[model samples]
Target: MRRVFMIGGAITKFGKHTERNLKSLAAEAISGALADADVAKEALQGVWVGNAAQGVLTGQESVRGQVVLRALGIGGIPVVNVENACASSATALYGAGALVALGEMDVALVVGMEKMYLDDRTRVLSAFSGCMDVEALPELTRNFANQQERVKKGMQRGGAKKKKSRERSIFMDFYASLALEHMEKYKSTQRQLAVIASKNHYHSTMNPLAQYQNSLTIEEVLEAPEVVWPFTTPMCSPIGDGAAAMVICSDEYARRIGARHSVEVAACMIASGEDRSKITESTLSRLAKKAYERAGVGPEDIDLAELHDATAFGELYSTEELGFCPLGEGGVFAEAGHSTLGGKLPINVSGGLESQGHPIGATGVRQLVELYWHLTGRAGRRQVQGAKVGLAQNNGGSIEGAEGALSVTILKA
Candidate 1:
């Protein structure tokens, strides 16, 4: 198989891009990545764009990659569009990497863009729901609402009370339900969840490109609005917009057209959550194992990681699943600061999607951008010292509590 290397990667500051649409967002990120990699746009053989809800958000579906490519002034090259909810971007990355590995293309540009805040909250909420298995999610919302009512009652009784009107992301409600089960099975606590949130917040502060650049105290995270029992607003990802793009090329291509930043794609593995039940799927465990198998390195060999931490609970659960910590001990791991920078193996130095904001299709690629900086030692304040091996795990969709679509990538300098 041909070796694939990341020649360049970039993402727009991930938040509400009220100033841009999908095409403009794609152009900006692609332009930045191409410039960063020191490659001309014309050098790219093809482009792949990963997105979900754009059709609902803007009525532009097929040929999305072509439309965006043309708008960006890049000509004639083939463009592909992929969607797998939040995993859409990872899907794009996989396609691009496959192209290089197959020698079908020497260089490929993979981009992920999503615009969610175009309409009011209801419409945005509607679009968000559309990302799920449509049939199951509508029923899930009722279940979420019902559960939130119970949380509200507990709040009325002064158990984790906050004075604001509570809201729950449909995913969170599903997560909350799954998390509550995990808590019960594993004897987890809200404090443990807070530890995860606080850790990501602290790390995000070091990331200039992160959406939330300030640290949050454990107390502040714990005291935030309770969206679901055992989950505060601080623990959840926000609705947002942005774009991420990467230039993937062959090893020879990189040596011929060198750039200041070059991170080798040591291993790239894509897996799905099929056998793992929603209640049983350990997102970290399954995803991490596949990554290690492909990368020829175990979790302990990893110096740092950019994980799929869409919520504080996700950070906790994913850590356990990823083998950084034993099952049911992720909370203990977080409280010890093991996942923070300067710890045994720091994770989410980019603040994660929790603070970085999960812009659906853009999120997976953004995780790669974080991993790129760590591998190349470009993540200044958040740099993991002497880091040579880095891993990134991005999973989208939920089969119960586990991720439906999953990817793990190992990068090295």
Candidate 2:
């Protein structure tokens, strides 16, 4: 198999873009990526577009890739539409890399875009409900109710108030439940979660394209309105609209074009969550192990990471699962400053989803764009010193006990 290299990557400022449509957002990112790669639109051999909720959100269902690419004056290419929930764009990158590695395509364009901010906030929240199995939503709701009851009981016992809000998605409840479990099993504190959120917010201040670019203290994060117990509004990723794109090509094409500062795709591993009844390895752990084996690197070798921190707990849990630290020590790891810039292994120097803004389908691709900038010494203020190996973990959708789709991509400078 030929090696795959990312020649260019670009992302729009991730925030609530009420003026942009799907095609316009995609075109902006695609144009930026093409310019960055120094590759003309005519040189692209294939196109992969990642989007999750355009059909429900915008009523544009089929031929999304075709429509978007055609609007950019690119046509007759193998346009593939990918929808893997939040990992949509990352999975598109994985597929594009595979095509290039197999020598089927010399150059491929991967774009992930989503327009999530609609006039109706409830409609926006309802769109996320599609990430789960719709048929099983009743059961899931029951489970959520039970979890809420448990949380209420725990709060009552501790003399804490039960904050209420119907504004957020069910994912927060899921995250809160997972956090409670972590707290119960490992004695992790809400303060630690706040620390992680605050760190990401601080990182965002250095990121011009981040949705929330204000620095947040740990106290502010903890004092913010509670979305779920232990999770302040600052701990969660906001609903946003954005797009990210990248140009990936084979090794020969990279050298032929004299691609400057091209980052090598060491490994792109995609996996599905399994039905595991025990507290053993998670899908992310299994995928990360495979990625390390394929890339001939380990967590110790990874200098930085862009993780799917849709919530602060997501980062904490992923740090442990990715072998950055020992199991159940993610909170401790964050509290010790190991995951911050200039720390041992800086994770989410791009502010992560918590502050960078998670645009569902675009988020995974955005993570890679951040890693590409970091690996190529392009991340200005939030750059990690001496970052050589970078990892991106993007997971999408929720099943009974795991993510429906997960992608782990490792890159080298």
Candidate 3:
């Protein structure tokens, strides 16, 4: 495949845009990206749009790409719609990159947009449930019974104050189970999870596009309202509305257009989750291994990253799976400050999903936008100095006991 270059990208502020629709958000991001790339809509050879739950949330079903882009006077191109749960936009990016790499198109636009902040919160939450296997939900949730009891006992022993559980995303329970398992097996503490949350909150203060800019102390995070045993409200990502867009082109196109700040897509790989009982490398680990090998780099060579921290535990677990730290020692790694700014390798400098906001479809593309800024020395305050190599890990949905779909993208300056 030919080399792909990301010439430009942009993201809207991530927050509860209750008044906005998908088209408004997409237009803003797409306009910003086009301006950044110094290209016009006419230059886009094809368009790929990533959105999940749009049909369920807003009743906008198929032809999402054509519907959104057409309103902006962009039409008559091959518009592909992608829905891969949370990895929708990343999958869209992968598609655009592939076509560009294969000489099918020189320039392509990838847009990820989601409008999830609605008055009917139940409907919003239910959209998340749709990402999983509905047929097996009965059996899957039944399995939660035993794990819930085990988690409760463990939390009680750890002296965790019980907070009444409210209606929240089912993913929280999954993360809670993972946290409990990690704690039981590795002796990691809930306080370590709080530390990760606190760090991301602090990092969000530097990200103007982040949904929550207020930094929470570790103590504050620990004392906040609990979503699950070890996860406080601040430790989980909020439902939000946002959009992110990117302008990808072939290396030749970049040179021909005099693109001065293009970031090379060294490697991008997508993998589906396997049976948890297999006991081999997890989905993310296997994907990351392929990405690193294809990029001719290792975890240590990465300067910064934007991980899918749907929950603080998600970040902790990902740090281990991506080989950023030794297996089962993610808590220890964060406690040592290795994953914070100016440390060995900063992770989630954009505040991650916890603070930066996970707009589902937008998150995958938003990650690359953050990394592109840092790679080009444009990240205002949270910039990792001298950042050259960056990685982004985004996963969506859930299978038997793993992420339904996972993607890893490596970028180099």
Candidate 4:
């Protein structure tokens, strides 16, 4: 297989955009990406678009890519639509890179865009519920509620003010259960989770495209209104709308075109959660190992990272699973300030899903856009100095015992 490199990437401001449609948001990001790459629309050999909630929220089912691209006068090429819960765009990037690596195309574009904000909040949330097996949701709902109750009983503490129930996403409950289990088994504290959240909030203050850029303190995060027993409002990702796009090309194509600011696609590995009871290693751990091997690098070689912090717990959990820290020490890892800026290994420098906003399909690609900026020395205030290698971990949906889809992508300057 040939090598691939990302020439350019861009993202729209991530927040509530009820006035905008999918086509408009996509056009802005795609146009910016193409401009950044110094390539015209006609240069794209194929296109991959990722979205998750348009079908449920706006009745836009199939052919989402064609509809959005045609509006920009980009057509007459292979167009693929991808949806893998929150990993939609990351999965799309993997596909585009594979095609380039196999010589199927020289230049390709991958876009992840979503329109999630609606007047009816239930409709927006039902879209999230659709990520899982719809048929099993009946039983899953019961199990999820039971797990929440169990975690609450296990906590045996109270006094957090209750927040609006309508604002809670189903995934919040999932993360809460996982966080509580970690707390119970490893003796981690909610304060550690708050530290993660507070740090990301501060990071977003420097990210103009982030949804909520205001900083919060650990004490403030702890005192915020509770979504679930252990989770406060700021600990969870807010529903938002945005788009992100990337322009990738084969190394031969880049050299032929005299591409100057390209970053190597060292590795992009995507996988699904297997039966954990039968498997010895978890999905993310297995993927991270394969990615490091493919990139000829180890975890210590990473200069910075952008993890899928759907909730603060998601960041903490990923920190350990990705080998950034030892098992059961993610909470301690954050408490020690190892994951913050200018630390051992800065993480979620884009503010992550929690503070940057989680637009489902767009989030995975958005992480890459942030990494691309940092790797190319375009990230302004949040940039990691001399960042040569960056890693992104994005997971989506929920399965019997793990995430429905997970990906680990490593990039090098």
TM-score of 4: 0.97
Highest-lDDT candidate: 3
Full-model lDDT for every candidate: 0.81, 0.91, 0.92, 0.91
Q: Report the CA-based lDDT of candidate 4 relative to the real structure.
A: 0.91
lDDT of model 1 at position 101: 88
lDDT of 3 at 270: 93
Off by over 4 Å in 2: 156-166
lDDT (tens digit, per residue) of candidate 4 on 1-413: 99999998889999999788989999999999999988899989999998888999999999899999999999999999998899999999999999999999999999999999999989988998888778888887788789877765665565643554456777887788788778878988888999999999999999999999999999999888888867888889999999999999999999898885799989999998887678887889989999999999999999999999999999999999999999899989999989898898999988899999999999988998898899989999898999999999999998774799999999999
Q: Candidate 2, TM-score vs. the true structure?
A: 0.97
Q: Which ten residues in a row have the lowest lDDT in candidate 3?
A: 153-162
Q: Candidate 3 regions off by >4 Å? A: 157-161
| Clash list (residue pairs), candidate 4 | none
Per residue, candidate 3 scores C-alpha lDDT tens digits across 46-88 of: 9999999899988899998898898999998899999999999
Q: How many clashes does the backbone of model 3 have?
A: 0
Clashes of 4: 0
The TM-score of candidate 1 is 0.93
